[model samples]
Target: DQQVKQNSPSLSVQEGRISILNCDYTNSMFDYFLWYKKYPAEGPTFLISISSIKDKNEDGRFTVFLNKSAKHLSLHIVPSQPGDSAVYFCAASDSSGNTGKLIFGQGTTLQVKP
Candidate 1:
């Protein structure tokens, strides 16, 4: 079973528009959540993260909201830019070490039209 799921495999938006990506999880033990953005061949870069104890976290153009009750989380990018066009991955962990061993969803490819 997919512990984490990103229903949409891809999303397309115009530059300067808002881009919202959704994620869902079934495991309650997962206490830490993270979002990573990846390019063609390089490894994913950590964008933002939210702990289960918190409801929301934001960083500049990126905001992540976590709804523990519903086991859902979302990443919102305001004024999405062409440079943001890449694959995004949602990951979860249970207070584990940061060995790059995170349970990741398939990934959502975002295409921004300039």
Candidate 2:
């Protein structure tokens, strides 16, 4: 049973447009949500994160929203640029465990066409 899932394998957007990525989790234990951006052959880079306690969090042009009741989350990137084209991954952690283990969803490849 995969706890985290990104149903969409890929997404395409035009430059300066908005890009939205969605994620869902089956485990209610997940209390923290994180988004990561990755380029081929490079380690994933942390983008933004939100706690289950908050419904929304925003930083710069990136925003993350979490609906605890639905066990769902989404990342929004506004005015997406060509440089923003990359594989995005959503990850969740159960802070109660304190083991520092994260469950990652299958990444969604984002193509920002310029």
Candidate 3:
């Protein structure tokens, strides 16, 4: 019973194309959503995030969209570069505390071809 799920295990795209990654959550109490990118041996680096209060949030080439009612969220990366190839993780956390615990989805491996 994973609360967070990334049904797609992997995604591939051309260097200059858009890469769309999808996620779903079963927990309705979650109000914060985040997307993180991880390289081989390093910890995941935060990319973009969206709160339940907003439908979308964008940062440079990355954007995150959240649909609270459907319990779905997606991250879009425009003009993905070869350097962008990495494993992406979707995470959810309740706003109820500063404990900093997060429920994460199975990561999606993104391959950006040069």
Candidate 4:
């Protein structure tokens, strides 16, 4: 089973607060992890990523941490803004080859109130 799972369907936070999203995976073969953010009708845009060899990766306002032993990963957004309200999807792929196939979690919708 190569399923990536986002246990929570939504999260709410006040502006300037911290927002955290969680995800889990069943496939140990997945070596690369990515988080994507999506607005209304648009496709998901890549936010951050980390390899299995690394425990964490951070972007400007986003950070992703991976726990290989637990088969879990999480995304953290500091100083969350109203513009961060959107659906976030966690994806995984096997880096062994160039298949370009990504397994995505159901998604977590985050709402930031100003």
Displacement of residue 74 (Cα, Å) in model 1 is 0.3
Candidate 4 lDDT, tens digit per residue, 1-114? Answer: 539999999999999999999999999999999999999999999899999999999889899999999999999999899999999999999978889899999999999999
Residue 22 deviation, candidate 4, in Å?
Answer: 0.4
The estimated TM-scores of all candidates read 0.94, 0.98, 0.96, 0.96
What's model 1's lDDT at 90? 99
For residue 53, model 2's alpha carbon misses the true position, in angstroms, by 0.8
Pairs that collide, model 3? none
Instruction: State the displacement of the C-alpha of residue 67, model 3, in Å, after optimal TM-score superposition.
Output: 0.8
Which candidate gets the maximum TM-score versus the true structure?
Answer: 2
lDDT of 4: 0.96
Q: How far is candidate 1 from the true structure (C-alpha RMSD, Å)?
A: 1.8
lDDT of 3 by residue, 11-79 (tens): 999999999999999999899999999999999998888989999999999999998889999999998
Question: Which regions of candidate 2 fall more than 4 Å away from where they truly are?
Answer: none
Which TM-score value belongs to model 2? 0.98
Predictions in order: lDDT: 0.95, 0.97, 0.94, 0.96
Q: List the residue pairs that clash in candidate 1.
A: none
Could you give candidate 2's per-residue lDDT for residues 31-81 as a string of tens digits? 999999999999999999999889999999999999998899999999899
Candidate 3 matches the true fold with a TM-score of 0.96
Worst 10 residues of 1 by lDDT: 94-103
